[model samples]
Target: MDTAMQDRALGAVLAGACGDALGAPYEFGPPLVAEQPVEMRGGGPFGWEPGEWTDDTSMAIPVLEAVANGARWNETRTHGRLLAAWSDWAQDAPDVGAQTRAVLGRLTANTEDAARAAALAVHEQQGRSAGNGSLMRTAPLALGFLGDGGKRPLAVAARRVSDLTHHEDDAGDACVLWTVAIRHAVRRGKLDVRRGVPLLPRERRTLWLDRIAEAEHSAPADHTERNGWVVAALQAAVSAISTGDGLVDTLERAVRGGGDTDTVAAITGGLAGALAGASALPEQWTVLVHGWPGKRLDWLRSLAVRAVDRTPGPLGMPVRRS
Candidate 1:
């Protein structure tokens, strides 16, 4: 890949991580002005404090690692790698959702029916929950499988990885849509979610809506939250691109929009980064973010090259000859 494309990929990764770290401290707050650190602490609560990313990015890293190492779809090896990564992150035990933590705990115990039981428990308790967790970690799937000339194969692979924990049809479908959308955005530098939403086909959309409605209907009556809010995240991402807004603004809107802040910010930020590239990010924010970083930034840069370099052209050949 050329320098420009490489930089774009790196930018996407950095943007995603930076967004996650910046939004972490204010995951649950009001829409207008979410609580952040005091200005004396660096003009923001988490600023200058070496922002720490949560499970959103943690889960994504292994997905990239697995793809880079050539893990196949639905394979036990791939699933095991994902589980092992979750285990490693679980050891540190950062602030994670109750449902996610419980699933991880069971997986760690090495129980006989750990995987099945965990999936069932999440589905039962959450009623086929379709949160943004699946979408947040799906960027790599887009980057990894782009131009592979097999959307079905790629979607199946990405879905298996997503379904390791989130098995709901809508969640899985959303994960696929987000992944493919990012791939197109990164490659072409643009995509229309509104246009793409309808392209999902009636049957598929109905399937997704069904699962979402099931989760919503099964949800306690006290729950007034809208499951369609997840679509709001997708809309927010598309709006960021259409309106030419910066990554931070887009991410802030996603987070403050409420209901699954981190995941929404993560998915939105990932798409924005892929569309806008690293240069689109604010220099000050990038410097601050990269300053405290390790392989997260470096891997992002490398993966960007890989993303462009891997796109296949006519007759399954590489489109751009490096």
Candidate 2:
């Protein structure tokens, strides 16, 4: 693996975990701007300890695990492995959402058909299932498919991964948009959220493009976004990054948005962390913050290295960022 890609990959995962743990203490609370320099303080409503990340990072770990050994995005076999992983994760993790539980609850070892059925059943029961649950865990897909070709291959991976649980097209759009943006961030050290819009399916592109504009132009507080809706979650992450500077600044801004602080910060962390590299992450948190489901920082780093290195590339990869 290229040393730079490895560092950026590590940065993306570690920073995301850092943001989740940092925002945990402030989850669903008032703005924490005054409480700047957010740390891995934990102790959110979920009763997590300091330095323990929430479901955000735990969910992504499966994606990294499933694909780290040269798994292609298009293989149906890959979805089966991911589903089994999610089933295993939900067994012990105490913080799963109701929608996710309902979807994954109906699955067995064979998951693709079951996932689709469960998604439809949940959607019918709830009247809507386009939550940020899928989007929050999608960064690993970005990492897994890093340099695997271009926008469309990564785009397809995003949709397939999102469809595994959050099957609604809106939720799929949010995942695709963010996943591609993360690809840009990790590859180029910058996240152009708009860059992914043009690559979307025509119908999905319209709504997603509008979402990007709203996120870019609106006030951070204007969205009043919780961590539920994919659009709202996307807006929250983009708004926080638009105004905040540096790693801590951006993450703190997301946490200060209050409701769903961990998810919002986590979303921003993947993007900002990719741009900044793992070395840019604060050493204090790096020493303390680790993931759940039996994953540590070093383990995740190895998975990320494999995710980037073991994957194959497209015939004519474009000239994206370095």
Best by lDDT: 2
| Candidate 1 overall lDDT versus native | 0.57
Worst 10 residues of 2 by lDDT: 312-321
Model 2, position 288: C-alpha lDDT score = 78
> What C-alpha lDDT, on a 0 to 100 scale, does residue 48 get in candidate 1?
31
For candidate 2, the per-residue lDDT at 290 reads 76
Q: Which ten residues in a row have the lowest lDDT in candidate 1?
A: 37-46
Task: For candidate 2, list the clashing residue pairs, or say none.
Answer: none
Candidate 1 backbone clash number = 1
- 181-289 per-residue lDDT for model 1 (tens digits): 6666665666534223344546787654444344333311111244233444444444434443566666665555544455556676787787777777765555544
Quantify all predictions' global Cα lDDT against the true fold: 0.57, 0.77
| Deviation (Å) of 140 in candidate 2 | 1.3
Clashes of each: 1, 0
TM-score against native, each model: 0.76, 0.92
